[model samples]
Target chain A: MQSELHNGINVDIQEYADLIEESPSFQDEQYAALVTSAQNLVSAARSARVTSYGSEEGNGHMGLCFYFPTQTDLDSTIGDAYADLGLSQASPIWANYVNSSTRTTNND
Target chain B: MNLVLATTILLFLTITILFGCSEDRVTRTGIEPEADNQTWGVLIYAAGNYEGDQLSGPSMSSSRAVATVRVMETELNSPQTMTQACLATPAAQGEVGIYDVEFSPRQPVGLLNSELVANLGSVSTGDPQTLRMFLETSLSQMHADHYVLCLAGDGHGWQGMMGDYNNELGMLIDKLREEIESVSYLLPGGKFDILALYARNMGTIENVYELRNTADLVLTSTFNVEQPHHKIIAEWYRDLQSQPELNRDELAAYMIDAERLAQDTSEAVFFTTLWNTNTMNDVAAAFDTHSAQTGLRPAQLRLRLC
Candidate 1:
């Protein structure tokens, strides 16, 4: 994940990839625990500044980003690099999503 | 008439002055004692040639590297703290220097009076060997109970961090972990107490997980980290000096507070994360399981524009 200007790249892909994984059986308790843990993490992150910008001055900064490529990104050089990563090979979650997006764009 | 009284008073004053000037009496000569074990040793590796032409004057003229050193000099003051910085700047021949930095009480704040300990003639800052060499030399020479290693430069996320413009090289993420691991044994707990990444967009799972074993705590940002904001690190040092018993978690929290507070609305997009290397394994496992259950769905994959 990269910023708008491409100066910075987000590296928190593991958590995002896990979030994409779905089970046959719904585990409410487990999901609740995950949510609680995520909330605790967010709470621990105390900011001194009243406001932090993401895209613009007023826009808030999102802490994490996952690899979910669109049709345009899939057709670009970045898509090739993304495909080459070990995570892409090990986990088909992101790859499947990218393929679906590409098919949707092609169909449109 | 009172010659005996005057002589006795002069003699007493002379004796007091002599005792005050005793070698045991501590004075702020600003020079650190030789071979003394320090409470903390801060090792800073800054790739200073981030901007400007290589053939021109040095790139550290007003770079973040020099600013970090200045912050350390002014804010980091502890008799038990030893600070060293290895700066890689683009000179006529691409100069790299190791400096022993200390706060000079004699001079006003904001002005650094650092000592150049050694000059490494033309070395690639992007090389893992160079980083390992610096770590080895600094850790072996500067004996400390705890160490904080600060890596400052531009980051390439998981690919690597730090760009050596002169040599046109970048240190790979895996290589970085290997370099630090090589010197981890010399550390008190077989790892650095804190690994502070003073680069932009290095708060990735790939890099952090790879380096989890090398440090107890990892301080980095998922987005662009304002280099000037790193002055909070010097403040953290000051706090650490005042409270030597502050644990790693507490210190990490303190840093988070300091960094967040240091930011203002004037700054654009500030986000930093303090990863506890101890629990990284749990995070990885839990997330892995969750990913397996959910799998990949187009409907679930929401595109975040930001």
Candidate 2:
């Protein structure tokens, strides 16, 4: 179902579903999206961890963990987790990454 | 004897006139004539393609306009190769003479990853080469007085590309620094007055030091990670063209105001500045005040590392 939330964010669960159904590329790859997302997540995680070390060399490392995930499982988990933390579904950076990754994985 | 002397004088005058005319022709066509001392030069470097991201909005139509205005205001002459009417000429005889150049490449959806990698490589290669070429050509030509570089595009400091899925902003900055140093080595005495970056997501305090290390001043937007508002930017260019004395802080304040107006019905707008120690810190301070007034937190990223 598609719905608009109070914080000016929009959520369309079916839109995610449609993306999976339509992508031919997603069909061709064997867990390609999953791998891509995992890589991104790993990179982001590493960046975040480095920054968390409080070293001067890692000052701008916070943004590293904030990347698009390519894996479906990770996408769903992260999305749901963020949603629980109050990030709206309409947030393009996080939501789009999650939706696209999930769609690619579902199609495969 | 008097008639002979008069005839000789007339012939000499005629020859001199003809030679002068020929020289003028050569200067007008083959070479740029010497500009007056009052003339200044501006170079605009528009780099990094975003394929129109959601946060930053869309690609700008008036980037060319900004370049053009800067050129016209400075009354400098641009290269024949940069035939665009709005682009300014190089400076006559200063560090500002050498200007770096970079361009963004177009990309489609599925090709984002590969395209990003390829373009990053090209950007790196082009960045240094462009600066080096500008320095060589400017010094040899000796036509510029000071140099100003405008790195126009979507920017996010320390982070890779802001709007695009493929770009790494950190990598791009590193490449730019490398190229700047390379150019500096080639032209040890030359100077870059400022590096005006027309981009987004780089308004915070942290980005300032990283950016200011390479250039005298860094001008960019604070938030709204998409393409900047065209009319606002055009207007800003117009103002700068009319009044070159406008300090960097004044420019930052204006950008913050524009950002506020643009984001009134949307999201928060932010921006900041990093100036060389010699530059007036008032501009950065003004930017902070404006950002705070608009409920946007100013990242105090200014440091004296260089």
Candidate 3:
């Protein structure tokens, strides 16, 4: 089971490294090694069994969480704060996607 | 006469330079002479009033803060102790106090049981300056070989934490990073040994990246933090007392092992993970690259995972 998890993490790491390779700034062996380490940590976290509220089967808690908010939440003051985050500011594509989604959600 | 005048001017300039460069020139030294340097000092910036109604009773947030202090008190060995924990929280009517966590066997006593070491007059926990002051005062007075800063309050991942309605302030992640960095600048090591987030949803890459330079290791939860982890920390405290030289990696591994043990013993699922902040920059950059390439909206990614 551990080997299988390790394999899955390697695949994810390779895919992540490939994406970074496309970016000119991060095209280095050091970046690849760091990505591998992070993915391994994330995989170890996801392999752990999490249980919430006395139920062992339905705990949805993952090892590493990302900022994914509902459209309403994204439109609120909290969303304003989220948009101002360094990550959001760094990734214009992500920011644009969020902005477009908010627009689409509002139109709907 | 000219020679005597030159000599006297040189002597006056030397005295002026000595006084100007003296430590006594700085007001509010933020140090306590009575505080003995210990192996580990844990400072908890606990804001209790952020979660529940102030009129009814102690909020769940405040209750958790009290429970955490109690757990520390139970594990702390007095008279020959190498671990010192302090609780800094808002008291009645806009008053904030940093209390010394002492070993007390009395039943049902809350934060009042601890000794009031420093009273920070009329400050909101939501303010970044308040956090800086708390850290500066505690770091100077606690006097530890290493330090673990525990932020115990309500959190919404990267949005904010430790909100104060009275002061109308919210402590954003950026402000938190700056506050910790400023305090670290004053420390000998220039960073905290460990930064433990007792709040929820703080394990996100962005939040961790923001705090990368503040601590060697960041201990936080991806979801709600379990109460059992407090006991895990207390256990680590006991281990620290025995070893007194546990490195950051060793301490992180020990806490992770304790979490795994807690999970094995019961149905409670814990999402606590420790990340080396040194590696967070590359992780965050890689994540940004992946996000840009995928062109997936944050919500859509969540939906796809679900």
Candidate 4:
């Protein structure tokens, strides 16, 4: 499970980096590092059974929460990022971060 | 020859008078002057906690009542304590106060006990239906310049949960709007001036937008819970009351800043407005201007997710 989670994170990071590079305006190293760090934190949390809960029958538990600085920050950053990348205003998957430790029940 | 001379002179005089009147007439172009007396009415409703005992419900109600009392005591011209302020007085005629009431579990339709019954000048409270009736009657009887409704409890856009069942915030706002609309019929010249709104997070934005077709402006926080910033809110209220010259847009901008500061704890703060498209840009420009004037760097915050 840990290796699988690590692989998933690696793939996501590569995709994010590719998207960032495609938009030359957001190629700054600071932005790249922030994304990478956040991804790693999420990946580590996902892999550890200490965070995730697995039921005896089969399925794994899932819960997610993102701790942004504030609602305004979230709005501005997401809006600006989407505008810079010429992306649509619909909700992006990047905003979702799983809180594995909080997961208690699993329904397969 | 005498009749022709008289008719010609009369025609010339009429033409001259018409031209002079046109030139002297007021065009009515500039902005209207602000009113002398500005009354801000804030109403907060917190109900539907049935599982708890009657005492618990009233306790929560009293907490909100205390908050309102504090805001009034500090911001209003009068300096009365909460208990004394609840009582009716000459100052109470123009003062800000809260009417808090709770209902017993068995008698959910009626009010258990009303605190401001004796001093029922302009403010009153009871069960939801009773409160609605009072507001409708009072608005019809009196003239209010500004109206603010702060619904303090759990609410979704169309659904609300105070205790067990779900209620509709939109419906409540609609009811209030209907009451106010009826009251407008009795005003002088059958018209009244409507100002902005300051409300809690529970469905305020949606509610404001729905009711604000008749109002001038609406201000609300984005969160769904109440984090009371009495000091800051009172200060902002005082600032607005003092500056009768500020326009609606300017007042809205100031409120955005106040909400941001109230919601944010860090040195840096951020805020957005659904009504004002250029609000963020204005805030950024203001920060830049202040920074240039003071030669100090504003606080920095990196956006991780938004």
Candidate 5:
């Protein structure tokens, strides 16, 4: 997503917050309340913009990853909730340590 | 006299085989030696109506469901834990019937009667109502001092666990919570002992937090659940029998130990989290305070262990 300028300056965390607050989709209850809650947290932290990862345009400012002051801060803030949604599953299912050919079936 | 007796016995046996007993009748009337001491109730919901690349094993939910039920049968019949566990698992798109497993018979699921399922008409395996009916029926008719509800099959964390070929929404965690509560209300005594998520990559922090108030203990892995998921469970029951009453942490530790020894799936090698649901409020409180400080929209902070 293009970072729209505020007063002709780079958008800061506060501006990001305003954008998130305005979007009705963020609070959509159709999804799990937990998903909504997690997204809301990420939206609030986007303002920090201390670190940005992911693509900016097509995916709409999607890949930015922020750096936190401390690991504990991250865990207490959004990391814990993020992990719950299976976001870490974004990692490759097979880490090469385990051969896929022999992957055990949860089924028979 | 001998010929007459032999012919009469043969005719009697044939009649009994043809119409003597029904599976449902056996389930309602049959008695296990341990019924009075039966503390654990195992209920499995397997939603395998379709297949995709992101799945494991036979890819047939029904077969795997029985495979798991069979593995538990072996454990329950073992000399060490003959009377410790009782089970009822529903696999595939089937009617809502809880098969209370009995080991002496070596049946796939002891209320096993394919005829019963066919006659009743099957429900989509992913329907929460399926679970509700199973629990409601089992608790009312089966004897158990406690219970363990196992939801096996593909799990997309809080997105939902069991998927139905018929229903797009499938069985969400909220629906599961409602069913479990309903069972507890119908059969009140002990807290619902545990809710086991035997699906893949389910050990998420948020999912567990959402279930903190749902059960006393939650057993699930954060990564993809490797094959032979039922082996660890059987052994856990065996061990728990000897160690009868463990607090949440102790039970979690035991499960971790069982997984290490029996399950070889590398995906299941490390990502297991035991939620003593009762203690989750404190954990959630920590997150809530930080989220409060971070405001409504927080950043995905990258932090490393020192």
Candidate 6:
């Protein structure tokens, strides 16, 4: 999911945003603590997918996706992260995409 | 009488120095000298010097150059029309000699200095100037009407030709533009025809931006070049060598066909090609990949998982 064309990590920014909300006090400058926790979960998901071939219930939801409460939620969460990081506001910002494969997709 | 002799001596010295300078003269324009006949030039700059401990680990670039030159010699009928420049290792610790490769059955594949040879030096491949010199020598001396500059070495996609070697692809393209500009002057229109990158990770979109103006056509790969990659390309060239007249696009297409066929045979980590040219502008081409994972949304990326 990492690319030179785009900026930042490939995982969903909203997941990190949700985790950051959980922490009462503000963490490090760039929300390092929140990102670290989110990244570890992503790593676990990726590791699990390595052996997750036969475990599929065949529901056809193995492909990952990101859903928002609203499109505004998507824009607010992803756009704010982009502004904070000073990354290119171009097409290939994959962090905004729901390009995950390691975990099952749901309306979480 | 003494003044006349001294003047004559000075004139002689000046002539000799100028002539010597001309012999070593490098054209920085990066332009191709125009020729009436169709001539093909392939320059393979193989930087095998691996900095530290990796030097001892299975280095085959020198042999790979030998193999490619051998193929060219064997398959190609018109030796005079085709020219190849190979820069490779086994000379010194951090340097490589750029050899003028001709199809000589009597001689070895890469003989250092022969009647057919041009220049000799253990030039550092890590230096950007050295890379420019190699290209300059090819365009100025070979005098090919049409050129196919092949980068046959280690490469990192966006970072460029050689990250460890110090030149980035972007800067290399910047340097090459001057040469391309020089070549463009001779022709009715555009610059030197094709740039074939036989190294690793050179077919990405990141590379396309750097290479847009440097070459008319680029033959590059998304994956790290495998052991069998060069041999497959050689085989393709051997087959195409029979065809007397094939334009730039046809030639590149043939190479891509061979690449796709070769990708089928090997279990590579990743394999994709970007057949980029002036004609195929801004279009993203997808690859036919094989994978074991049974993700229902196969297109989204099952190949990455497996």
Best by DockQ: 3
Give the range where candidate 3 chain B is weakest over 10 consecutive residues by summed lDDT: B25-34
Shift of residue B66 alpha carbon in model 2, Å: 9.4
Of 2 and 5, the candidate ranking higher by lDDT: 5
How big is the positional error of residue B96 in model 3, measured in Å on the Cα after superposition?
2.6
Model 4 per-residue lDDT at B200? 30
- Kindly indicate the candidate among 1 and 3 with the higher lDDT: 1
DockQ score of the complex predicted as candidate 4: 0.03
lDDT of 5 by residue, B1-306 (tens): 999999999999988876656453344323433345444445555444424212254522235555555555444432212221222234333444445454433453433422222122466556777666666665665455556667766676555666645653356555666667766665435456667777765654446656655667777765543445656666676676556555544555666566666554433333444456655544444334433333333333221100
lDDT per residue (tens digit) for residues A18-81 in model 4: 5445655653655544444444444432332111111222111121111122334334432232
| lDDT score at residue A97, model 5, on the 0-100 scale | 11
Rate residue B105 of model 6 by lDDT.
Answer: 37
Q: Report the number of the highest-lDDT candidate.
A: 1
Q: List the lowest-lDDT window of 10 residues for candidate 1 chain B.
A: B52-61
Order the candidate numbers by lDDT, best to worst.
1, 3, 5, 6, 2, 4
Give candidate 2 regions above 4 Å deviation.
Answer: A1-108, B1-39, B53-144, B159-170, B185-190, B204-206, B227-233, B244-268, B274-306
Reference-based lDDT, each prediction:
0.60, 0.36, 0.59, 0.33, 0.46, 0.44
- Write model 3 residue lDDT over B1-306, tens digit each, in one string: 999999999999999888865533221111223336565677777665554322223432335555566666555543223333334344445566777666543553446555676777767777888788778777766666677788876676777776554543358898888898988766659999888876766767678777878888888777654444455566666665556667666766766666554455355555566777766655555555555434434454431110
Per-residue lDDT of B303 in model 3: 12
Docking tier of model 6: it is incorrect
Tens-digit per-residue lDDT, B162-252, candidate 6: 3333333322333434544555554324555777676665654335434556677666545544434456556666655566356666666
RMSD of 1: 9.2
The window of 10 residues in a row where model 2 chain A has the poorest summed lDDT is A46-55
The model with the greater TM-score, 1 or 6, is 1
Candidate 6 chain B, which ten residues in sequence have the lowest lDDT sum? B287-296
Top-TM-score candidate index: 3
Using DockQ as the measure, name the better of candidate 3 and candidate 5: 3
* Candidate 1 residue-wise lDDT at B237: 65
Query: What's the ranking of the predictions by TM-score, best on top?
Result: 3, 1, 5, 6, 2, 4
